[model samples]
Target: MAAVRKSTNWFAIGVTAAVLVVVLIVAGVVWFANSQATSPGTLPESSAVNTETGAIAVGSGDKTVDTYIDFMCPVCNQFEQAYGPTLDQLVASDEITLNIHPISILDRASQGTEYSTRSASAAYCVAVDDAANVPAFVKALYAQQPSENTAGLDDATLASVAASVGASDAATSCISDGTYTRFVTAMTQNTPVQPGSGGIATPTIAVNGTVLSNQTDLTGDPQKDIVDRLNG
Candidate 1:
């Protein structure tokens, strides 16, 4: 009877150890999945794309102007509406090189559709297929920007938006497949931390590699502020 009791106890301990091992395996799998979800899966390949800086280069000016934007961010759309013309003028005049970084930090606002990531990825698709149409596509995206917590534009609508901007058939295919979503995630993670914020924010503008401050740099007139910064 004593031997049987000891054997039962050992069996119980083995079963508990087996359960723990299974639990540990599950935990590891969950961790891996989360990591991969956020990982920069692949870098975009294009003459207009700067993988090192994670920006879609538009102009070949001397001074660099980088705008980190999330498509789902309302503030970003507002920024575009306010300064899109100024930036376009600057680019056209070759005053500043516009590096548009299509990032995804507002995925939480997209009701699980991950609109921010999808749109940004679609931008990359356009960049890949037709780099020149990128600016138009960006403007069109903000023109039809969806409200927060909504599912946002479906894949087909995104494709149509691209097509409206003259993006090619391959660009539409890329948008539908979400080829650069992981790339957008990686860029969002690496988004430059602005001064005083201590966190990532959309429409974060950097002039000549210096992050601008809303208080000191942008004093009510963003257009003048950016122009002055470029000329400064």
Candidate 2:
């Protein structure tokens, strides 16, 4: 894209992004459903969300998938586009729950990481009023995911995008205030691999207790679709 021009110092984005995306997708196995504790039960490892109670496992199914995604990441956008329909079906059938843990790899990989964090956290503020809107808002952001280091979406545009989904101006205001920087930081630092999940990049998905490594996290096998039966 013109925005993510090659003229700049974007040479650094060479192989890291490609490698990161591939590993995350084809590496995970499955999340442990037997355990209720916060620890990683066994092999296949897990991508977890550190919660108040314990480590919350996530993914997509009749149960739940603890999803860790970055807003400004292209792969994340692709995942949403491919799998979001399945998510809607699951929500309708009340068969699956997505505990999405949005992080900020945009800064690490793209320039929009910080802005994406703001946009995401702002959506969180909006979700406080209506939780269903977060997915829709996230979908929009991903649809607009540009190359790394592109900027222009200020607080107003972000808020507008949020409002289009359901978030209010007040929620947008809260996002602009930059309250969730810590959450974003914590997300980036998460490894999300066998050892951990902090160091990993965006769109890291964990089903039940199993971290999926079969296909691309962005465009997986669409388990949500199987349950929904919205096929052609």
Candidate 3:
């Protein structure tokens, strides 16, 4: 009877130890998941703004052209490639002030890598660290935009792209750390509704608060159709 009692006590101790181990494992997993869901803290000064409805102003002109883009959106990339040169010329000539709003709406398309947010965050890093190179950086990013459902460009690749576009070393750290990821997340979540457009969409172009009904109106001709539309 004494031997049986001792055996039962040992069994109980082993079971208790296993239960504690399982509880610790569950707690650790919960903590990790929570951390992943939370933002990384405040954004850098250069890229800081009200992520809900703010934009990065480029060029100062009487006319304001607001462009909303997402790095992972194929249509946004196409729009950039088509109208990018014309827009740049307009900004350079002071004909229009380009308000480039880099938002993240296609994070789901990046195979869980959150490429849209990562790329947008990297752009913000460039906007703050190398303000003059924002256009170049943006062009570079879209030029090499990855296809959906892929891992997308890694941090090192993004940093390298920034460097190619004249972004300083500081931009590299900002990109690697994903400093503006939360900002991008916020912007994506809180996109404002535009008149006539219903909900916000990538590559949405608005001229002086009037969202353009037709994207193909520009026709890639800065001196002709684009200028006509802008002037009109």
Q: CA lDDT of each candidate? A: 0.88, 0.58, 0.79
Q: Which residue runs does candidate 1 get wrong by more than 4 Å? A: 1-38
Q: Model 2's lDDT to the true fold?
A: 0.58
**TM-score for each model:** 0.83, 0.63, 0.74
Query: Per-residue alpha-carbon lDDT of model 2 for 4-36, expressed as tens digits?
Result: 655755555767788888777665423332232
lDDT of 1 by residue, 1-232 (tens): 5565433588889999999999999999999999998778777899999876679999889998899998889988888878888889989998888999999888898889999999999999999988899999999999999999999999999999999999999988888888999888778776788789888788788998999865466564655778887787
In angstroms, what RMSD does candidate 1 have relative to the true structure?
4.6
Q: Quickly count the clashes in candidate 3.
A: 0
C-alpha lDDT of candidate 1 relative to the true structure: 0.88
Model 3 RMSD, rounded to 1 decimal: 7.8
For candidate 3, write residues 1-232 as lDDT tens digits.
5565433588889999999999999999999988877654555465433344547777888887878888888888888877888888889999888878888888888889989888888888888886678888888888898998888999999999999988899999989999888877766655555556677778777777667644444455545545666777
Best by lDDT: 1
